[model samples]
Target: MHLFSRFQFRDWLLANDPALSRLRMASRVTLTILLVFLILLAIEAFILPLPTAAFGLGIVLSIEGGVAVRDKGNARQLVTRLFGCAVSLVVVAIAAGLEDQRVLSDLVFLVIILLASAGRVFGPRGFAIGMFAFTSYFMGAYFQPPLAELPEVAIGPVVSVLVGHMVRAVLLPDDWRRDLLRSLESVSGRINQILFKLAALAASGDIGEADRQELRQLEDRLKEVVLMAETFIPRPSAGVFDGASNPAAELAIRLFDAHLAAESAIVLSFQSPPPFALVHAVIGADAAELKRYEGMIEASKDQPQGETVRALLWLGEARRQLTEAINRGGACGFSGVDAAKDTAQAQAIDFSLANPLLRSALQITLASAIAMGFGLLLSRERWFWAVLASFLVFTNTNSRGDTAMKALSRSLGTVFGIAMGLVLATLISGEPDIAIPVMAICIFLAFYFLQVSYATMTFFISIVLCLVYGMTGVLTLDLLKLRIGETVIGAAAGTAVAFVVFPARTRGALDAALARWFQALRELLGAIGEGKSGFELIALSQKIDACYRDVTVAARPLGSSWSVVTRPGQIRQTLAIFLSCTYWARVLARSYEAPPADDDQRRLITADLALVDDAASRGSACFFIKRKASRTAGRHLPVSREGARVGLEMVGSALERLYPQADTLPFASGEAIARSKQG
Candidate 1:
């Protein structure tokens, strides 16, 4: 709970992230803005011809690119940023051209909203580009110039993106690759420290709950580190670093793989307490092996005698490999070639013309078209705001609940922002001397809160707009009120489209996520029953993490109709059962579950465990669908000390409880509709 701890900080992000990482991000943005503001001041002092207000957009675009920079990934990362900016520029210019024609302009605005919202089908970056492009269109339309000067005005915004990034590079010169490596190096050191602690514990022939918790946390952290490494590591010969000099690509890959191996070894070593004599022997053997490692974790032909010794040797080998990878310099002897293949390289993006996407695109496009027509009938000048609102409202919504969530946030935030903007406008009405400085503070805040809180970000955005309008002699209370009105109309239109066009329920999405987890859990149980290596369980853990993330996302918008679903704590209780069962299943999978003494014993245990798996999978499906478990598959599992049998019972306890309650809850919609009619 320490505010500054990077681990806890990451948990604070709306999207899960490490804390120091994003705070550093906020600082980088703030510094970049300050620098941009200084440069503009100097330009104005020198009576520079360029529009200072116009340069604001450019600086924001460029600094925004800085937010994505990573270690060893300078080349491709920059290309993506520039591509985003390039596309955004075109979108704005097109919007500029549409500004003169009344009826046509509204059509153009609606089309932009549709295109931008549909871009979410491609993924996060695409969504960012779409959102930026759509917003930029509003900027361009608002700052429309004569055809003669339009190209000149466009240059400022285009160049500003570059300037922002340049400022960031100068201020935060360390870059992400170095920062990421430092993080890995830090984790590696902690791992070595932990291994040393475990060896000591083994020697003492004792392991406490505290020591065990430390090991578990380390395991969890290592998994996160591996996932983090994969995200930023450029592919083999991908040339993220300067061409032909991909110095650290292989090194990073080995770091991840070695860490994974070491993680498994550590967990396995701690799974069962070993005797003092055996632990003492392992320490001696480990020391001897360390001396022979010679900075390389050579797979040895000599077999270790005891289980503890074997795990210790694995740890030693993994540590050696990591040390070698870390030490090997540019084009050194360590061929991290195998490391490259394990990391799945990126593939071409293809958002197929498929349903959900097709339906979503149709809904947004049609809804915006209607919103635009309504806005145009009201007033052409203000219609842009209406279309902008619709674009923001529908951009990333997956269901009616999500749409309503966004609509309410957007409308409420805009209202608050407008009111705040009015107050600020009144204060700065005649203070030309302080206006620019105040604007600079607003600019810094707007970018700093970009992702932390949407409502807060919108509040600063309104302030920035007011400051800009004041400078341009366009600030007016009446205009602010008009924007609020237009935005409200757009929100209503967008929300209506969401509910009427595709009425998706949060419960359904949650059910789909649960189904995914069930399938993965079933596979994992089968793997454990079949006695697969525990190291392979990492893949299943990743699958579970993905499913958990989906559940979290689905749950966020559930407030829209959750009252219509099961009672308050029902879903959570079911989830708790699922999580506990899976945790134990994973633990069981990791254990060196000694095989049964006879074929009959093995078959009997496997059948019992399989029934547990079946009951779990079916029970979950039935819970979501509100139906009774038809096939009573499980019985009192034969109690045994063999790991597999014991694990089956551990997992079965939850499923047995789940089966009885499966038919209790009905779909919220049926009940919700009835209540709505009565009201």
Candidate 2:
């Protein structure tokens, strides 16, 4: 029984994470390397030297940027891989030419770093190429390969790229449609799982702390599944058809609606002295309805176009039924205080920075220079370690706080890695049999946690490095200590430069994110007011969701994570407002799908929408200009439309949440919720 429970928990964990997908990719990369080596051995071919083998592995790991490029044509994937190979070879050749002159080599290496970092302007492919270039330069400087050996060294990357291409194009080619269907099924299954848990809790009429934590975990997992589904599902094709007409967009909305329905159900389950009987009944019904929809969706995966549309309609109806059930069980009467549970934000890489990339490039280049200078003083041979650490700290970081946090994570990871590496090296110093497998496990774990935790990935990578040294007969305490020292110097240098040169404060970024979120909300409000219900509304809704995600990410440094918050309550309220506004905005956008039944209803909705739109506009203005908003503390917008009334009530609730203490200005009037009977 215990074993079954453990297996069930393991399955639950896998369903919630993108772990299976990541594990598959990791396995593919690992197997590609193994197969390439095996094929060469079988043919009695000249084996690649260690340096070149590592180069090939790097190319295979990063060239296509993982699953992002999986859907591209074979030719395109080949071109991308070749581009990475060519960049690495050219960079290495340049490094070989400059190796004879130390002063000149360092100067040129910094320039290469700047350009490589700045290559992000072109997008993901560009970033991958940049990563290859930087890694190649570092390898060249570290290996000091003679120019005569360049041709031989180039063979590894070429072979690696070709083998990787084969693996992607033939061995395990991605079928995006199939993957999308699988992700959709995963989302559906997780929702059903959560609904079942909620039903059980309601039936038992006992919501313990353990149950709450489990529910939150389930919600978080469902959130991951939904995000993955959205990513796997292709965007609506650009054509004469509006967004709403695109079947893909409708399917995405259905996923979003399903997530919201599950979230609402969770909130209702947590209500005090709640409607346990009705909650159990409603959730039981929702689970059954969702199960039926899942069956149809699964069947549609193999059918023609019309079947997908029919399946999407059924999915939407299932979501609608669940939502209506929650509403009837007094969703609004719960006061929604518990509804603002923290939702994890996906990692935000600031690729939108056209000019900021250049600035970051410059900053990273300067920090790398500082790190190299000090690192050489520690150990000339391993100076590149510091430089690599410094350069990486700047990647995917927007604000100075992000840089600082990343630097801290890198430093702490290095410390932990050093400790573990020392112990492992001591125990497995002469055992290649065990060392090799341990190294492989480290690589596997590194990739598995690569997206989940930077520190954990770094720890595994450090272990691999230590094992490599052990196998090479150079494992020493001095070397490991040097690694830690250089890493700290590099991290400190990067963090210092981030704060000193064109510092981007986390608070400023948070405010900017909030501003953008409000601006998207305003646009969504405008669409709602104009009665735009097709693709336009969907587009705006997506934008709002995107902005909300950004806000959550931006607010991270201010939360409990880094201990930067001076007012924890203020931070909580800020996040709560973000969650509430996003929820209500989505509810409003999705609910206003039809025109008003008559002119009386139209006028009421139009008037109430105007009021809310104006408030959104004002909210945008306040955040954009960083000024106190105009107070409308006691004013009201009477509404006869149910949706409009609910929206106004949410606005009032949000304002109260914001200005709980004093007579401070708010995003809108706190008393605008004047609910009236339907006329």
Candidate 2: segments with Cα more than 4 A from true spot: 1-14, 36-73, 200-221, 238-250, 272-354, 534-539, 560-568, 596-641, 661-679
Indicate the residue-level lDDT of 390 in model 2: 95
Q: Write one digit per residue (lDDT tens) for candidate 1, span 1-679.
A: 4656875333334123332354456666666666655655565568555553256555555454555333233444455557677776786667667767846765676677667667666655656566566666666676665455655555555555555556555655544444444445544555555565676776776666556546655555555554554444445443232322444544543554455445545544554443444334333445654454423323521222233344455555556666655555223423433223344356665566555765777677777776777877677667767777776676555667778878887788788887887788778877867877776676566656666566676677777777777777888878888877888888888888888876666566666776777677666656655665433443454455556546546665644343233333344444445544554454445443444224433443354345455664553353343333222112211111244444454555444445553454332221232233246
**Regions of model 1 farther than 4 Å from truth:** 1-19, 28-48, 51-53, 59-72, 117-132, 167-355, 377-379, 420-452, 466-476, 560-568, 593-645, 661-679
Error of 1 at 620 (Å): 7.1
**What C-alpha lDDT, on a 0 to 100 scale, does residue 241 get in candidate 2?**
27
Best candidate, lDDT-wise? Answer: 2
Compared to the true structure, candidate 2 yields what TM-score?
0.77
lDDT of 2: 0.63
Tens-digit lDDT string for candidate 2 (1-679): 9999997775565574543676667666666666665554543346544454344444444423453333246787787778888988898888888888977888888998988888776666667777777877888888787888887667656666778878877886765554555566566568767757865775676877557657755765676676676665455343112444444445555666687666545543454312343334344455564455555544534333223223233334555543443343233332321121224344555654446877788899999999989998998789888998999899778899889888988888888977898789889989988987887777777777766677887898788888878888887888888889999999999999999987888877877786687677667656665667655665576666677677767767654442233222445445545555565565556556656334443444444444444454444232222223222222221111354445544544563444343445344432332232222
